[model samples]
Target: MSAGLRVAGVDGCPRLADGSGGWIAVIIEPGNAMKAERIDRLAELVDRPEAPQIIAVDMPIGLPKRVGPNGRAPERLVRPRLGMRQSSVFSMPSRAAVYAALDPRLPDEAERYRHACSVARATSEPPRAVSRQAFHIFGKIAEIDGLLRERAALAGRIHECHPEVSFWAMNGETALDLAKKVKNAPHKPGLALRRRLLAAQGFAEALTSPLQARALKVGEDDLIDACAAAWTARRIAHGQAIGFPTPAERDGEGLPIQIQA
Candidate 1:
């Protein structure tokens, strides 16, 4: 393994308004024991010689279509595998909806309807309810859009992934059904499951090390999620990672809309 080929995993702090809410990243070499860290700005953080050869993010990359209010193919393809926890996979609003949500004059419902309508009409998608929770991350989504559109080198290196999907792949192995994000499980069962899986892959330090723990800005779950994403990043670096849709669909700009886990 050369020093240049690194893999990274990233997760966003959901509620920040100014696009500086915070982001956590875990980096590991393809064949090394472990090399992980948390950072606030993902694009700027990895802009160097040691930048990841592959980056798997927990946010949506390719958005849904607006042809007719239809939802994103990636979310639709992945939901069944999650079973009762399908709620974890929300419909990605169309690019138009995202831009509309950013307008200062639009109220919450009006903006959401605008997004729903835009995605459906432009992409021929079915009208999917855009959740307020999903709308909240508009800022973070915008940040990634800026990165990909501007940086030609990062276009394919950074992939869209889901931590929930990754957790299922790690814990279940079969991919038919998998783990949950544990919204409020006692003793944090979801976190524990994710930690145990990463620990098995030599990432115990990423979870328990004092230095790493101090770097976690959000809650324990976010830290755990970043680690899970790193585990998936390892698989991606090793050519073992699998995508949700074998033949993924792409947005108008040609970015893939598949979840790799």
Candidate 2:
């Protein structure tokens, strides 16, 4: 990679003991060296002195006001491409529902979840509620959503990516046979399969190597996924990436809804 070019792959991490969960970024900089960093806010990573030119993050980016039976176009388009791994993509609800999940007035998590579901059911066709997995990342979804809304330029730099989608592209558009997690726990075979793909993409050993405390407060899967996201970021930077939809779609707020890899 050129010294002037910098890109990153970012993924959300589990909350630590003190309830501080943020984002993990695998940055590819000059000399093709990889650097891992923990950021409490996505903006922190974006505004750093050596900020990446492109950031591929594993999280939902656009939010629609009302979703149809197939959900958002991006989700609908990419799900089938993953085959058995399609379940990894969660159906996102309406913008109102996502915003409701972070309602400051509803301090109780259970209450907020119910309220968000109620809003989602009303805004979606065929009436669907927010899934627990989707609800859990609403904060992250909201974080990037709000930032993009506040500064439209970042939307051009920060793109939405899914690990499976990135890996699928890296694997010659073939979906992997294994699931990264089973019953909510890491699966070694699946993780190893992804590492091989990353290694082939020119990711350094520091990233594909065995897990260590190199980047604290994040799971092994988070690091791998981030690297996969970074792989897509590299493609994106080079104009070689493809969006889920042939042409990117947009939300009511004008944010691009396509997942690029």
Name the best candidate (by TM-score): 2
lDDT of 2 by residue, 101-141 (tens): 99999999999999999999999999999889999999999
Model 2: which ten-residue window has the lowest total lDDT? 208-217
TM-score versus the correct structure, for each prediction = 0.81, 0.95
- Using alpha carbons, what is the TM-score of model 2? 0.95
How high is the CA lDDT of each candidate model? 0.68, 0.88
Pairs in steric clash, model 2: none
- Candidate 2, 145: how far from true, in Å? 0.5
Model 1 CA deviation exceeding 4 Å by range: 1-4, 14-21, 30-36, 67-70, 104-125, 174-187, 205-215
Residue 258 Cα positional deviation in candidate 2, in Å, after optimal superposition: 0.4
lDDT of 1 by residue, 1-261 (tens): 344467888887643455544787777764664555546566765587667888888888876546332357778777777766677777776787776667666667665556655553454444454576777777788778778877856866888888778877876653423343444442345555666777777786545443464454455666667777877777777778888787777778777778889
